[model samples]
Target: MPDPTDVEKARSQRRAWEQNELRDFLERQPESQQEYRSASGLPVQRVYTPEDIADTPFEDIGLPGQYPFLRGPYPTMYRARPWTMRQIAGFGTGPDTNGRFRYLIAQGQTGLSVDFDMPTLMGYDSDDPRSFGEVGREGVAIDTLDDMADLFDGIDLERISVSMTINPSAWILLAMYVALAKSRSLDLAKLSGTTQADILKEYIAQKEWIYPIRPSMRIVRDMIVYGAEHLPRYNPVNISGYHMSEAGATAIQELAFTIANGIAYVEQVAATGLAVDCFAPRLSFYFVAQADFFEEVAKFRAARRIWAKIMKQRFGARKPESMRLRFHCQTAAMTLTKAQPLNNIVRTAFEALSAVLGGAQSLHTNGLDEAYAIPSEMAMKVALRTQQIIAEETRITEVVDPLGGSYYVEAMTNEIEEAVNRILKEVEELGGAVAAIEAGYFQRGLADSAYTSARAQASGKRTVIGVNKYVEAPQKDAIEIHRNDPDVEARQIQRVKAVRASRDNSRVATLLDALAEQARNPSANLMPITIELVEARASMGEIVKRLREVFGSYAESPTF
Candidate 1:
């Protein structure tokens, strides 16, 4: 039973309306063989009317904080509590990252999202030979508790939520976060943050992982079980689709694969001795808001509906909170360009608006200067201010899901939901996300989409403002790039060496031994040992190295 008000209103509007200006202009215009179209190859009509979304429901497409959550996760959303002003940053060493964190905080960033270098992701200490030339290169290198302490030196861990974009070695890092907060005497139960412990997606898309799929799932299950009982306020896994999009997925592919991955993780944890209603509520997700504004908005809406359905129908999620798909979205970093980079401000503004409209829990906009290097100080401020202005100046936030009843948006939402369900069916036919990953289902899909898009750009079928449509001479004067503090690695090494010197070497070894024992014995829950190691302030590398010994690293098959 669909609500009839919107449909009836649309009928009346279409019956009475006239595009007189369009009719006049077309009558005087010369006929041409060429035709313009949307990048997705959809026709560009002169206008859309209520006739477009005439069948949409006023109730099913209800207000924010309600079922379907087409509007948003909360009724007041940003009006009640503004979206987290989190900026992605981490580079050089611990102290270097700490300084950058402080700088972003000063620039009005509401939260911290840490990006780690290769060594940290691979679970290697900075001085390890395998980590040569990699530590502290692209993102911060954290190997020890001293590094973790330095990473949040002056910042109060309880006040601001932290998002650590790390997996495979997530447990070790999460342990360090808990330890640091404990050092500040912050309540363990009240610690706020999320760790990117989504290792299944590592196998699916990102490929930054240290363990085989099954062992990794076991580790993730343990973290969920542990976080439920221990760090209740902290989210254990941020099931991410941002990397999938960066890996060249179309918007729908990102949506389906990410949701399917979430399904897989929830299934695994549910099989664990814990109740489904227990930890599912703490789960969080990360997604990328792509350039197709309406399409992206629809994707978010569909995701919420699909997730709610998945939780209720599939996982038997009883709590409304458990059924809700709370997520953090960042603008597509892949869309930002080094050419006419200033135009990225315009690019980011629209994407940010789309995120707000789609009802994101929080968002991170890429810096205008990101494509070239870690954004300069000024560039970061502009990015943060971009979100602030949209929040403060734009009254869009005052209304929850203002576009909810729009014909095109609701239609697109249904379209994407159906497309994602079809893709999920195909994925299931290949034996679910992990098996699909093993078969390269996701990888090949993305490669095909990327190839198609690239060809379109090359043939000028798609218009990317400056790149394809409006050609302009390149802007002069390179963006100011931030350099690695040359002495950072040395300082980090000294800090680790000193911590290792002061820590009880025997106790550290004993805790490391216990962690190794737990990893070796699959039936043993590692949380008990991890909490002990965390309480002792064991370094991230020390714990990760022990797990690496047991579970071993993964090697992915390359694309043909």
Candidate 2:
């Protein structure tokens, strides 16, 4: 901590600079905008001094890996080991995605993130009528254990951390992963990965929910409990603000809403007779690194602080690990543009840097061509290289929390933390995340923020370089678009049919019946039964169909 007298002297110096030095500078050249603000509309000052953070206590911004974790979650941070570089790979058939996964791993990518097709995400099979034409269009198609096996083919699951970006059908995919590991004689305890099983975000932003809030939350709880007890290395749920942020939430809103969702899950899990420490330590988060460089960095810092307090005070968690907020970050896909596709490379680089500075445990940089479609192989390689350059070339990792004591960053961190807490309090008053979702509170806030941002971009208030400011003439041959394989859907459909034909129908039916029975039982942990169903050769669609009969489908209420 600095001397109070020195801080006071610095305050005087700041006043003098504004009065004389800044006045003369402004007279010579006027400021560009009448008001400077961040992407989330937080006011930005021209200069910051010690006076900005004079009132803050030293303990509030303690050392890295300490209480509150404002500096960072780990003490050495990237110095000990750089964040895991994960490229989200999934497109075409299972074999196609598996090939891409191998390419990325061979390129030195450290982690794996799987993207599921629209049908897979929505819990539909490739052969279902509703899934026609859309199968394997957006991502890889997985209809059964065979597809899951093909997806991971020769990869060592025990070594690589896998992140599955699916929610509605996350449980089934997780089960398939477990079954695959068991078949290979791999210990379930050693398998590492995250099931992006945050269903509240589905109702709040993505709208990919299968069951209604109550039963869906039950599934989340079951996974948390099971993961805590059995799969200690696997993160059952990645409480995500990435989708919510992409859908138009401000940084503060994203932080608040994501934590609110996390609080709900903690409560739900605790209700299952599990101690807070049992599951809290395994709870991880996923967030987006948007274009606001300082603001994004500050948001991550503040998130760690807020979460530490919540786990300790709110939930009575005693373990330090339980209080530490571990998270994975991805570059904001919404920030990418098709107008000048190559410019996205620069955008992703800066966002990736922000995530690194903010202390992400793992990160996925968006591919330059992702604005148009799934990234091409070259585009994906470039994204992976972006992270490598930051981790290796930049000596920024040499120092932990290099920006910890910066006046501007500290001020921003405090501002974000306070604002997030205020919003979280509002959520608590509205009866937690589920109640807020049902009452359209979260949805309305996200929609309004999104509309506001869209309008700002349209009106040129928020300048998106390629989309708003830069004017480029149309050229058909300038940028390459990654086209989806036309044969992908047919191949996926035939593969699923072939697997069904080969599997034992009677055994599959019996397993499905057992799963449905377990689903109906209020106290049952669904993970074990889900694993059994997958082992019995039950297809993703068949298992979801059986559970849907018990949980029923959800239809969101219109919120304007």
Per-residue alpha-carbon lDDT of candidate 1 for residues 1-560, written as tens digits (9 for 90 to 100): 13467557766665555356555666799445356443333444445666555555567577677765656767788778778989889888877888989999987888999999888998888777787777787789987766788888999887889999999888878877876777788898878889989987777677888888888889888888889998878999998988988877787888999998898888888876677889988999898988989888888888888888888888788887787788999998878887888899999999999998888888999889888887777887888899999988988888777777666777777777888999999988998888888888888887787788888878886667778878788877757777667776666667667877787888988989888987888777786788678667577677877877888878888773
Off by over 4 Å in 1: 1-58, 472-476, 534-538
TM-score, cand. 1 vs. native? 0.92
The CA lDDT of each predicted structure is 0.81, 0.91
Q: Which ten residues in a row have the lowest lDDT in candidate 2?
A: 473-482
TM-score of each: 0.92, 0.98
Candidate 1 lowest-lDDT run of ten: 36-45
lDDT of 2 by residue, 1-560 (tens): 46799899998888898899999999999999899988777899988888888889999999999999988899999888999999998888888999999999999999999999999999999999989988988889999998999999999999999999999899899989989998999998899999999999999998898998899999999888889988999999999999999999999999999999999999999998899988899999999999999999999999999999999999999999999999999999999988878899999999999999999999999989887778888899899999999999998999998889998999999999889988899999999989999899999998899999999989998889967887787556556767888988888989989988998899888888888898888899898988888887788888888889999999978665
Candidate 1 at 7: error in angstroms? 5.2
Clashing pairs in 1: 53-407
Error of 1 at 337 (Å): 1.2
